[model samples]
Target chain A: MTVQEKSWKEIPPAGICWKPSTEYLTGDWKTYKPIMDSEKCTRCTLCVIFCPDGAIHWNPGKEDIEFDYDFCKGCGICANECPTKAIEMKLE
Target chain B: MFSEWKFTAKDIAEKADLFMSGHRACAGCAAATVMRLVLKAVRGPIIATSATGCMEVVSSIYPYTSWATPWIHTAFENVAANASGIEAALKILKKKGRIKQQRIDVIAFAGDGGTYDIGIQALSGAVERGHDFLYVLYDNEAYMNTGIQRSGGTPHGASTTTSPAGTVIPGKVQYKKPIADIMVAHDMPYVATASPHYWRDLITKARKGIEVDGPAFLHTFAPCPRGWRSDPSKSIEISRIAVETCIFPLWEAINGEYQLSAPSKVIALRPERKKPVREYLKMQGRFRHLFTPKFEKIIDEIQQLTDKRWQRLLKKCGIV
Candidate 1:
């Protein structure tokens, strides 16, 4: 038997629906990215608080915060409410 | 009469303390209980892949971990794929005589969001390839990890954050995806649906799946107190009502033969079934608007559809 197998076709995520509680944007989430500006960030932690998946993280020593796009849903609450022009949305 | 039976020492041994008391799940999370039960049924070297959902978040919060086993967390849609990699690696290692014992079982744990919606194709492929692994779908009806979001497993006529009830529209508008039937359609080695409410039936089915040679899939109806808007205390009762009302029938399919574990318990009338659904809905802030007629019709439709499906299941089980 060959060790190589057929490549798996990526499954699309379920689109928006109302019947269930929340319509998670399923599909390839990797296509979108959440951009954060450390220069303008006040470090109030609003993005961290509002993020559902806990994708944003803060570094205490360097005073730099990071948003891991691997899990970010790109809901835009952070960019919408950023006290400074810190967070921006990106589609990768 | 049932109280006379005592839990034996061997039973306790079989039931390991994999999940100690201090783990942080919701007040009444059926999925947490399910994790305990599933881990108890399997021993030896095993790797578990879980999608991003309530169970993953609650059990594996950063800086605090609840699982005693080697578990991996990937994206929501690739749990099966991750498990496939783990299984393939283990298989190749065992075949090459590199790993001793060679008894690791690859398993994937997912909620309705990961299983029915995002992860279906990968899961289908893995099962179709006949990999020796297990997949457990812990269906809480909707996506609870993201603050009661809707998913494919959400039933019709239930109000969710997306499908709110008002004077004009009430509750969700679609039926749940028939995932079990879909799996059986693949002609997989084993397929079964059980609920934590039925412990003996669930444990038995898990045992059966473990013994099966090829791929196995188990769909579990796990209720969510926080998401379903039900009292924390009534989590188990609501799960029982779900089966008793025929909302979920416990059954198994082995090599295309269908066998129902038990008959759906029939109640007096629609009102009896409606009582628990209503009680469950009323406690949650999400369904507070269902007092109007639009909401009433949603419940009515749900009751009607469940009754029809229950009858069909009975026919399938050769009861009617």
Candidate 2:
């Protein structure tokens, strides 16, 4: 039997859903992407430490982490934690 | 067309109105307020499993009515267990297309007696099993439903039928159980402690907890006006004082990182903390024991412990 057939129930909805917004730290979904400044990159990993959700990432080859918007709560931990000022909490 | 409090008249009527009027809950029951706030966030067709306590007895008197949502009144120790069964069944039924989306969330409500003492093991088991549900403990610091006996959540010097103050024995020998700490130990996805005095905070925390992946626990300080023998209106004020005094800190733990949500500073910085504990204790009959010198020492110890915790929180939050 298929997963659905075997369980006789639908798959549960993924845990968190994001609501978009505007304003400086309002976390508007469409207006912004969590941008990282590669020039000041230290790859020190403090940004990842502060992220409420595990959305911030570090790429060893590119020498910087990326923010995954799908799961990010937009709590701005990364920007607050960036030691080199590489992560600025952009408007979104 | 008008608004009473924040809820529009239409909002009150049109919403589930789950905690209906004319129940036997004592005048100014804080747990009822908790239920009202909880209903605001969780739309039905939902199921609530309530353990036997003031809320259960008062709201669900056999035959006389109260709850608007589908609810199961279970033993004092089985609220979480029953809720888990409901949630598990709903999941299976939903996969088979037997239930609808609104029917997905099941909530378990318990009192301090149920949550901190009797029902703790069952709650821990269900949470560890990773059930998709929410457990709300309306803590009044004692078993108010059963003649105001001391439960695990009773404050240090609070007089209860069980731990009454006298010449030799002091009131409520043990400090309140750290329920949030216990839940955090389970590594649940979301855990929060909120008070009805903070409506927005309470609602936000409940919504977030429900939205999380696994079992989420919310421990709420629902002051018992009768059991506390305080003016009903002061329930909110007393709870607010508790938070300000760091006697009850409003915080949340998600995946083990603690976030200090209220005050954000040590009690010393908040002028309210300067208010004598007498302001809080004088309002409650439970603390009437403070009249004696022997019992007064417990009050001092409680204050010192609260100050220490507040200082630690401030230092950790870098607010000190």
Winning candidate number (lDDT): 2
Score every model by TM-score: 0.70, 0.71
lDDT string for model 1 (B144-228, tens) is: 8787777899877666777765655556677888899899888988899987656656766776776678888999888777778
- Mind giving the per-residue lDDT tens digits that candidate 2 earns over B127-166? 9889989899899888898899988888888878898878
Ten contiguous residues with the weakest lDDT in model 1 chain B: B1-10
Candidate 2 residue runs with Cα over 4 Å from true position: A1-92, B1-16, B263-276, B315-320
Q: Model 2 Cα displacement at B106 (Å)? A: 0.9
Query: What are the per-residue Cα lDDT tens digits for candidate 1 across A1-92?
Result: 12442333432233211121112222234444668776787776545433333345555566556675544544454565466858776777
Give the winner by TM-score.
Answer: 2
Give candidate 1 regions above 4 Å deviation. A1-92, B1-14, B263-291
Task: Score each candidate by Cα lDDT.
Answer: 0.67, 0.69
Q: How is the predicted docking of candidate 2 categorized under the CAPRI scheme?
A: incorrect
